[model samples]
Target: MESPITPFEPAIADEAIADLQQRLKLTRYPDEETVEDWSQGIPLAYVRELTDYWSAEYDMGRVCGTLNQWPNFLTEIEGLDIHFIYQRSPHSDATPLLLTHGWPGSVLEFRHVIDRLSNPTEYGGRAENAFHVVAPALPGYGFSAKPRAPGTTVQKIADLWIALMKRLGHERFLAHGGDWGSLVTQAVAVAPGTTCAGIHITLPVVAPDPETLESLLPEEVQALEAFNFYQDWDSGYSKQQSTRPQTLGYGLADSPTGQMAWIIEKYAQWCDCEVNGLRHPENAIPRDELLDTVMLYWLTNSGASSARLYWESFNNPDMAEIELSSAISLFPNEIFRSSERWARKKFLNLHYFNDKIAKGGHFSALEVPDLLTQELWQWREQLRALEIVA
Candidate 1:
């Protein structure tokens, strides 16, 4: 039998906050990057500035406060306590929607858009578009309990999510995700006996169709270039996390600055922050919001535990063809973009294909919640029109 669900509020002890402040106070920053831009990495000057604000000016209680405002809960799934935010839409007939986040992000990524999704009428959206939203912290991330043993792969997480939704009385639900979340969402869509009605993913893990190599469209050519860039310059973190997460964890677990730099670098690199020949994370997400994500890692000391997900699942992903109803959204600045034709090769029942989102990046829910929400709305409308979702 499943463990009884319990309400949860993050009651961080004062000592934890003090310890974080003290760590920030004692941070040993590295020398400034030789280049003026973020070529080498996040500029050391920006790290110092961010750490100064984090230690001195930022409100440490905001993470707990923001999480407390949501109806949070925990339940044992597969012998692990899973933490999640559950919001039932005011519209009783609203479709059940599971929202998952990727690496370097937490359930906090959904903070801006949870209520908007759960109560669409409040945001000038049709009531028909409302969703009974469920946003869960991945195992070993955020408040979710870390796995003590190996084998908690992305496919395993998908099974846990399916079980969690059934425990919440959602027998059939829709799903959406990006990054690692997108992989899990796809896994959920294809899991045996899965009750997932459909899925929408921003990062569909479909390779370029070999057939299209000779006559690549401009979009496909740009996608291949971006993929090459990621392989060459942007994927170092994945390498470390997938291979030596434990070795790297000691510094990140002990130093708040280390954790911040590790995560914030991704935010700057992946966000749609470039303008006028410059890129700044703050250009896409606010400083406090950026720190909000970092705080989730810092407070829980979850750097290593979270990175372990990569170690367990990154090297071997379940890239099976998705036979369920599916939708794909290709934001221009996304790390791995898929052309509609490329996605068509893998997602057999892809009912919605959009590559024209004018803005946003990997962290779409946080970076461009409105656009993401509209995409969800549009995906649902398309699914409904096809009678795939009712």
Candidate 2:
């Protein structure tokens, strides 16, 4: 018999909170970057400021309160207790949708839009757009059980998600995700005998077929350049996580400042933040919201275990062709973008592809929740139209 799903309330022990504060108070400062700007990873000054704020001003109670507002739960799936937030829509026939978060993110990423998506009419949206939303914390991340051994790859997570939805009484569901979650979503969509009705991925992991590369359009060429740039300059973290996560995890696990710097640096680099302009990711995303994500990793001691996923499946050679109906929402500053022609090579039944989103980046769900929510609603409408035609 499957383990019963139990109500979950996240609570960090007072001792842990006290330990975090003490660690922050005793943070050893690194020498300042030689040159100006974030060219040399996270600048010491910025990290210090953020760490100071996190230690002094941020309230863990408030963060916990925000999280508890949602209906959270835990259920055993494949010997792991999966943690998730399941919000049923007021509409009786609302579509069931699974939203997954990626690395450097948590279920907190979807908090802003869950209510809007679930209760559309209350949020100036049509009731027809309402959805019963479920956002799961990937294994070894958030409150989910950490794997003691290996083999929890994206493919495995996909299988767990299918079981999760079924256990929640959703025999069929829609799926959406970005980053690692996107990989899991694709896996779920392509798996044999999957009940995923449709999927909308912010970052579909599709690549150009080498044979068709010679006839690329200008936009396709630009997308390739972006991909190359990421491989060259921006993938150092991935490399470390994939090759020696245990080594890197020592520092991250021991030091709260180390954890904050590691994650905040990504928000600076990966979000649609203007370096010398009026808009910064810190401005686009509230400081408190960013710290809330950092706390999840720090409190759970997930710095190492989360990075282990990269080690397990970063280069897994299992990109099955997807025949399920799908949609892609391309953000402007996404590390890499694949043109429709290239994407079609893998997404055999690509029903909706939009590369014109004006803003946001890798963390679009957090940085631009309104726009992301709108795009998802629009994509759902497109899927509905296709179903009508069928």
Candidate 3:
């Protein structure tokens, strides 16, 4: 349990870096398609700009310093090497908080925000609201070794986080996540009396039944229609990854640009777009945000390992049949979806459901950190008030 302020050791060796650049230089690329500036894949011009910056000026030393500013640790649980940042308030009674990441994302996504959540007073908040932050690189992503055994579902990950918390001396805690993170956090709440006292999620699990919706709100029925579009059209990447991850992983693991293109497409298509990202057909997500995510994947060499989670998740039979249990002992589930208005739909004792028209799309955290941060803080405070009443 050595708590190093920073745990990034430059996963890529110097020789490997040199070799990767050589490969990039010599590798044949697909002929340039339209220069349509991101309705297509990573624009050739934009990618060259990113790769040039990567080769010449993207500072690993500076980036590592930025990342290490918060306390970090490396621990082994379930025979897997777990790398996480555990930052705590100076307060003796600080509440524990665990944050998980989704695919195409790593612990690095929060490198810029972990400190604020941990010591809010220093970062600007009452010391009473301070948190003990635990942001783990999900198993098979970033420094965490990919699972050797298959069937690593959200359930096992929740169990692992409980173990990690107890090992760190936390008896009770709060949790937060988005995208795949929201799903895994749901699983965490399902675990025994580890009792996440309060939980917040960015990605809500509210895909309303379209048929039920069409009659309810005919004028705004398109919102529900978009759900069908996502199931049919937007899920190609998930289908490919879940079905033949190794095939996709081989290309991504080998080529930085290849990996960049693969991930950039998702951000461009799914994030912060107007018109459901499908209705507009032409609204573009900005380049800086896309490259921000790309740089993380490239620097960490986390592409192969990240995809392995899909392979393990898809093939797991238990995951296929598992259902969310309705139990009061666990924390309530929060569901966030992009729709007409921010609404809360509760289901018995199991649902603490709420939604907001947050500023971003799928990768909400990266697409709009300020909005995401505010939303998380607001939700956490709401839960804190509830805990006091209970």
Every candidate's lDDT? 0.93, 0.88, 0.61
Candidate 1's residue-wise lDDT over 230-290, tens digit each? 9999999999999999999999999999999999999999999998979999999999999
So what's the TM-score on candidate 2? Answer: 0.97
Candidates ranked by TM-score, best first? Answer: 1, 2, 3
Query: In model 3, how large is the Cα lDDT of residue 173?
Result: 77
Q: Which stretches of candidate 1 lie over 4 Å from their true place?
A: none
Q: What is the C-alpha RMSD of each candidate to the true structure, in Å?
A: 0.7, 1.6, 5.4
* Ranking of candidates on lDDT, top first: 1, 2, 3
Model 3 / residue 75 / CA error / Å: 1.1
Candidate 2 lDDT over 1-390, as tens digits, reads: 988999999888999999999999999998999977777888887888888898889986666787899999999999999999999999876899999998888899898899989998887787888899999999999899999898999889999999999999998899999988898899889777889998889886766779877788887888889888889888899999999999999999999999988998888888998856633558668888989989989999999999998998997736678889988999998877888888898889999999998889989988898899999889878877877211
Higher-ranked by TM-score: 2 or 3? 2
Clashes of each: 0, 0, 2
Worst 10 residues of 3 by lDDT: 326-335
* Poorly placed runs, candidate 3 (over 4 Å): 1-12, 34-40, 207-211, 217-223, 273-296, 314-358, 388-390
Please give the lDDT score at residue 1 for candidate 3. 57
Report the Cα lDDT for residue 270, model 2: 83
